[model samples]
Target: MKLITLLPILLCLFTVAAKAQDNNGSNPQEKKVLKLINALPEIIASNKLRMKKDPQRLLKAYIEFTPTAKDKYYQVSVCDDFADRLFAYYRFKVNAATYAIFYDDFENGKLVPLKVWQKHAYGIYSKR
Candidate 1:
């Protein structure tokens, strides 16, 4: 009888866990990546930079910019190099499947991290 009662409880817990996973991808890392990718282009534009209609691959960039003429915190994601246009905006010399996030407020314009964005995106990532 105890096993019968425990079975239902286990199933319920499993269902809740599955739903959570559905809401957030099997790997939270991927979700974080998408969130970052979705906000790249606008950030670039807001910085007084112009970008082509597309990126090297797939990106849905956004930004949190001010109307005044001053640079602020920004985050960007570069999905791929399919269109060969990601670097056209930042004027950065990055390859593909990488992120070229720049922080105008960090270290007097020194591009930190240099790389390693894929392994530890969260370390440098910040959501709106």
Candidate 2:
């Protein structure tokens, strides 16, 4: 296969592998997520990490993570994956349970409900 033809497949496989593992390192990428989470109260408090719409940082993160904008799961999943990556960086040493909780929350698709927002109350709600 031509290099171009193989690229997308490789990117998808890479993304899946990366998302599936826990690096738990103090890398710059991990640090940035930690910083962003720290800076955002509702996000950290609600377990709601989101990328800015049309974010330049997120564009770069997507390339870094393997772009799959056509897939909503990938778009947000990658960002959520990074936040878990950052949390694990600190958590692996002292609180691995947190990592597991995070994984379960994400895999279960525990998203905040639209109703919660419409009702002006933040609560745990999941599509699953």
> Which digits, one per residue and each the tens of the lDDT, describe model 1 over residues 1-128?
99999999999987784332121223444455445544454444443322454443333332222123343223333333345333322312221234344333232454444343324443344334
Q: On residues 77-109, what C-alpha lDDT tens digit does candidate 2 reach at each position?
A: 223343334222111011122311121143444
How big is the positional error of residue 47 in model 2, measured in Å on the Cα after superposition?
15
Work out how many backbone clashes candidate 2 has: 0
Off by over 4 Å in 1: 1-26, 41-57, 60-79, 83-109, 112-128
Which 10-residue window of candidate 1 scores lowest in summed lDDT? 87-96
